[model samples]
Target chain A: MNLISEPGAGALILRVQEERIDAAVAIQFKDRLRELTAGGEGPVILDLSQVTFVDSSGLGAIVGAMKLLAPSRPLELAAMTPNVARVFRLTRMDSVFRIHATAPETALHVRAAG
Target chain B: MCAPPDDAALMPAMAPADCSALRGGDDCFRRNFRAEPLAVRDALRAAVARFARRMGPDDAGTLELTLAEVLNNVVEHAYAGLGAGPIDLTLCHAGGRLHCRIEDHGHPMPRLAAMGRAMPATDVACTDLAEGGWGWALVRSLTEGLAYRREGDRNLLTFEFRPACR
Candidate 1:
């Protein structure tokens, strides 16, 4: 469950290093994402290009990470693989989160787009 | 040295049979796993990959997602407090349809009345998104024949997927 974090201009780009996010690492994924974004001041762009699959538990974990920073920081997803994106589309979570083609450089893009 | 006779000439000739006739019969797969989340995930990945090789990737993805939701539910709710237990999974494919039956002794199926089956509102703001309730909805949407029954101490859930429908 290695996550590479890079602080961009006004956003934190957290790239998940795993190929699959399923029941096995759902809890660990949420906990680690929470820790990484706890002190960040701006929007968070979650890079999921490496994640090829996501199950229901994994979807829940992503939503849980968002709730952990509700009413303040926002969590956006980017570069989801086709299989992973299908899960979001099937569950209609694509409507709930701001999904992007790729990780944006700054929080300004997120704010401007939102 | 003398050359060996041709293999095809050495054997008796046989007529070709219908491929559909062979595919029409049930092809069954069964496995039992410890009611642990990681084990469940690994088993599902392997099984789904095998299925994909046989039934194409699209149908396999649907099956994988639905089964993941069901098995994860079993691990999270059924075997929650109880120690490791055996979870039985059986799959049969025939006539362009796949049937899956899962059995567990840990807990009876939860009452639908208690746990609502409604799809979470997708129109809500990002800050107010609900995550946990979407599993069942996706299962119902992707599967054709879904049935659940608790017989004695066993919880049996059966679902069917018609790949052609997708």
Candidate 2:
């Protein structure tokens, strides 16, 4: 349940260090994210490159985290493993959140190059 | 003959057990666990990973996702209000398909008939997007021959999956 946080381009990039986020840690995951992002301003980029699996509870936890932000801050996802990404795609949560193929640093680089 | 033989003697005698090495048929695995949310994920992941390995990585991943969803439902709804109970799972591979059977004694299946068994609308605005209902939809979309039954005190759910290439 360790999350590495980095600030990038007016956004907080939080990378999950775990390999799987399922029912076991879904509640704790949401609680930790809420605690970390509390009173924080600007968008949050959740980097899921290390996550290989996410179940319904994990997905709900993510959505719950988004709702916790409400109208003020947005939550974006980045660098999802193929398996993790499939859960989002299959559930169609891909449409709800902005997704990036790489971390914000890489995304920022691409934007600068363009 | 005197007293029509003793009651125990009148009963059929147990047959002698054959002692030999049993040949494995279809691959089968079973596990029983307490209906607790925290333990459900780990148990399911390990079991699904073991069986899915035989199919392939892709199918394994799919199986993990679908099974997780179903097991979570059991933990959330089935065990809700009721105290912790035993959740039994059996996985078998035969006829070129993987069959999963889950049994629990917590609660009966809810009114899924009204749910329409269809994927929810994903085209809605971001604000209107749903988080929860997607579980069953994903399970339905990935697996085939999904069925549910309740017999007396137990609830049984069965589903099957073919290989990814199939």
Candidate 3:
């Protein structure tokens, strides 16, 4: 699991560079998120444009990532594909986290206008 | 043609017969793989590829995700502490629904609690929200006809999916 971190304005954008984030890579994802955001002090927006699939374990890993940066920092999700969106809806986790329909910068504008 | 990863476990021998049933090259897929993450992933990719041309995108995605949930559970629970064991998966589409049967020589579920449980509570503090126990919900919501049985040393789980397109 390759995660690229881009420093946004007062926020951090973490991009998942894998096609699938299921049981095969959930632990790696959690460990990598911890490593990338160590000592970071801002809301982290996860860019899931490249992720085509995320199973229950992957969703748990994402939630774990959020709890890891709790109280001070937040982990947000962006650019959810249809399949990814379905998992969130079924688990009711979509309402728990802030979701974005577009990429990082584009979602910012969409949120502002809508 | 290039074979999928972990081709040794896939039994695509019936490919020609399966193709004769429908317009595309899918009606059944069978594989016997070790209950491990990478092996499960390979089986899923192969199954999706075999059925992709017959179903719509959402149905295809549904199949992959639901199968992942079921297969993952089998690995984490049934095969726990017993090392990776063999899992048999057979998928067939007929009468406008996809039928799935998975078998393994692992622990039998005590009561088939997966389909009986409700979704975990979502109305909670951010810090208190549950992270796991969500797979069963997805599995139940995505498929139907959930049944489980243990025959001798093998455990059989049967389920069905009604394609939204049908």
Q: Which candidate comes out best when scored by lDDT? A: 3
Superposed model 2: Cα runs more than 4 Å off = A105-114, B1-25
Query: Residue A30 deviation, candidate 1, in Å?
Result: 1.4
True-structure RMSD for candidate 2: 18.3
On DockQ, the stronger of 2 and 3 is 3
Q: Candidate 3, which CAPRI tier?
A: incorrect
Which interface RMSD values do the candidates have, in the order shown?
21.3, 24.9, 14.5
Pairs with backbone N, CA or C atoms under 3 Å apart (clashes), candidate 2: none
For each of the candidates, the C-alpha root-mean-square deviation to the true structure, in angstroms, is: 15.4, 18.3, 10.7
What is the lDDT of every predicted structure here?
0.75, 0.75, 0.81
Candidate order by DockQ, highest to lowest? 3, 1, 2
My TM-score estimates for the predictions, one after another, are 0.83, 0.83, 0.87
What tens digits encode model 2's per-residue C-alpha lDDT throughout B54-131? 665567778888878888888888889987788998888776677899999978977967224666665655455566
Candidate with the larger DockQ of 1 and 2: 1
